[model samples]
Target: MVSVDYLTKPLDIFKEMCRILKPGGLAIMSFSNRCFWTKAISIWTSTGDADHVLIVGSYFHYAGGFEPPEAVDISPNPGLTDPMYIVYSRKLATA
Candidate 1:
């Protein structure tokens, strides 16, 4: 039941996820892109002009829930919109 805003760092979120997950549990994370026009507009409309604080590549090792990470593509157009990829990762079982 933990909800965080875009202001939260990706590492912090990943750490929180690690804390909550069981030894072999899974976690799904969806993130927006600053390069996306819609997000860019939101940023311009907002005060900070900050669209996204985290990038897509940070999910490699930090996000561990899916043995083979799943990528969910959110971009309407590959060329027009900035692609947003949601990753589902699994935590490794420990001895």
Candidate 2:
């Protein structure tokens, strides 16, 4: 997941990911600080990097059938260039 802009309905995508994943499998979604502004959703384009993590986490929570999502900042240089981050969730064993 380089840019979330391509997703018209993110929740649906999350649900689909969960549906296809094996028990305890991880669904890791990553994104950068930059994206095609014209193609991104207003929330994605307007919010800061930290908020983007929250937004992605919400998708997992709302989609259900998964454990709590975890956020990670994997940026090599915080301010040198576009920062990179990831939000991952695991499908429940019983899901």
Candidate 3:
């Protein structure tokens, strides 16, 4: 999905993902420095890359029913343009 759609209603989408995922399944959210800025959420457009991780992590946390989210910086170049990251968590077996 596009950044605007996903970032704008992150919690709702996250909850839906959790609902459909089987127990022990993983939900992964990946993003990069690239996006359509005008269509993205204000927080998403305004924050630096590191904060983006926290913002996405917070979505997992607040949505409740998943494992604590973990963040990975899989950026090809740490300081270069288009840095990539993933914030992921698994559905709880009991969820």
Candidate 4:
């Protein structure tokens, strides 16, 4: 099984995943919500944990090579101020 860290650009990782996945097979990935207070604190504090990888909205938009992802709020009462977001996406056909 191939696993990559979230610090890697989402697009590059997605591209590689597309290459490895069997046709019609599904790949699952998780991204960090930049607005999450915990992430902010970690960054400000610089805890230096290897898990501290920042994935913001723009990363998906530009560096990550993804468009608007199909999203569902697992959390109750999702508002603009909410700090965490969970997104799920699937790879389309490869050219």
Q: Tens digit of lDDT per residue, candidate 1, span 1-95? A: 11222423656667667777787787766554453344333333353212232233244355544255555666678768765556566766750
Model 2 spans > 4 angstroms off: none
- Candidate 1 — which pairs collide? 64-90, 65-89, 65-90, 65-91, 66-89, 66-90
Query: How well is each residue in 1-95 modelled by candidate 2, as lDDT tens digits?
Result: 78665688988989999999999999999998778788889988888988999999999999999999999999988888779999999999999
Better of 2 and 3 by lDDT: 2
Q: Candidate 2: worst 10 consecutive residues by lDDT?
A: 1-10
Q: Write the per-residue lDDT of candidate 3 for residues 1-95, one digit (tens) a residue.
A: 22522366878988998999999999888888788777778888788888988998898899989999999998887776568888899999999
Give the distance in Å from residue 93's predicted Cα in candidate 2 to where it truly belongs. Answer: 0.7
- Model 1 TM-score on a 0 to 1 scale: 0.47
Off by over 4 Å in 1: 1-5, 32-54, 63-68, 74-84
Say which prediction, candidate 1 or candidate 3, comes out ahead on lDDT.
3
lDDT of each: 0.50, 0.90, 0.83, 0.40
What is the TM-score of candidate 3? 0.89
For model 2 the local lDDT of residue 32 reads: 88
> After superposing candidate 4, which stretches have Cα over 4 Å from the reference?
1-6, 31-68, 76-84
Candidate 4 residue lDDT tens string, 17-91? 556666544554433334334434443234322232233323333433234444434434555443333444444
